[model samples]
Target: MSRLTRTGQNVLTEAMMRIAVLGGTGLMGKLVVTAARDAGHDVVIAARSTGVDISTGMGMDAAFDGVDAVVDVSDHVTNNAKKAVAFFESAAENIAKAERKAGVKHHVLLSIVNCDDPRLKAFGYYQGKAAQERAVEASGIPFTILRSTQWFEFGEKTVSVMGFGPVALVPRMLSRPVAAKTVARSLLNCVEQGPSGRAADLAGPEDLEIPAMTRTILQRRGQRKLLIPISVPGAGKAMRSGALLPGPGSMSAGPTLEEWLSAR
Candidate 1:
């Protein structure tokens, strides 16, 4: 429970919360920690680098001590179905178990938009995210899920992953790339507002094609690589078909890809 006190003017005073960030050392996790701290909340960074492993449940007990909320931004970097599923399931279960014991009030998860879409069923990563959401839902803890579209960094990461020799293979995909900082702010909002169970999806201000994003990345980096637009099969095809875009009732933020790139 948040520490709130009513003042003489009948205005409630917001109490400082102690937030535990599961993937605190990672890109988005770091921003979340900073944002929480900047907002006068105490933050506990729980990550492998910080001597806590969520998948194995090691070091979680101490980290959750007196924690008001658990923000799980932990990520497993694998596209393999079995591995992704195993990792997310294990991590979510561990976090839930620990949170229950700690009597934490809120459980916040950062997931991908459209992860539950049928089109992404064949994608291992999306499957893992879906499974994670289910685990959190059944955890017996009050929870909120913030699903966000692809990050601006995804552009460069996709190019690097698909680059082969002088050519970069990219699927014809449409994505609204939001800035990580913007997403962090939204996560903090979820934390402050407590659990609302499946909050509105979060997306960027503008939608752009993947190949064009890749080209912009390459150009900005001064890398002259031939860009090949390839049609991906299965789930990749769904991704290219714009199934990942946020649906109605989503929350939109700024620092669009172009704006983010300019700032970078």
Candidate 2:
């Protein structure tokens, strides 16, 4: 039989492929799964609703069966270092173990652009992400680590979380944030390319301030809210100072803020 033809620069196996997404239920996961399906690859959703607990290794092997690639985007929402460490270690260990047993050819992990920096303000989560990236990098499987910028959806959700009876308190920070859908599309492109070690960092179409993003969301939603700009320290400063913006040559071709708001 003729070996399958190379698609492009990525290391792709010569066989029909099935891709399993580790956190296929959340916003970003949903976008990844959809993009994968739209790209004509077989897709699997591995999440709590799908009978898989990546954090505890429950039902992981079964979910990984016949899967040639896995995209891990699972998150443990907390501020505690110990809990973050434990969750990340277990989730990374379980996913890596299951993929190893399944002989998965490619592993994909979505991470922040500056997570490798120990000095970032969100150090706890950054530590977890950095450790997770290390696990993927060390695993025997060929892997692609996609380091992307902050998503506009996240910026919006952050505002939503700071509920003030109807008013949203916006933080003042700097970001070169992309849309979640755009990130999802880039992930799919990388998935098709298999694993390129580390793909270029993905950023937003334009640089934006945190307060401006929040105000745009509010204005677009037609909701009047107190756009309270408060001074946040540490990680907040890092973000406000454009720490999240991609360095030279980073990917930055997502929808603009005006486009993002109009679509919502």
Error of 2 at 229 (Å): 3.1
**How large is the C-alpha RMSD of every model relative to the true structure?**
3.2, 4.0
Best by lDDT: 1
TM-scores, all models, native as reference:
0.90, 0.89
Instruction: Give model 1's TM-score versus the native structure.
Output: 0.90
Please report, as a residue range, the 10-residue window in candidate 2 with the lowest summed lDDT: 1-10
Candidate 1 stretches greater than 4 Å from native? 1-12, 164-167
TM-score computed on alpha carbons, candidate 2: 0.89
Q: How accurate is candidate 2 locally (lDDT)?
A: 0.80
Clashing pairs in 1: none
True-vs-predicted CA distance for residue 150, candidate 2, Å: 1.0
| lDDT scores of the candidates, listed in order | 0.89, 0.80
**Looking at candidate 2, what is the lDDT of residue 239?**
62
Clashes of 1: 0
* lDDT (Cα, tens digit) per residue for candidate 2, span 1-264: 113345576655443468999889999999999887766678899999999998789999999999988988778876556677677877888888999899998898899998766457465777678777887788778999999877888756877788677677776767788899998888877777878998999988888887888777777778777778775545666766766677887877768988877777
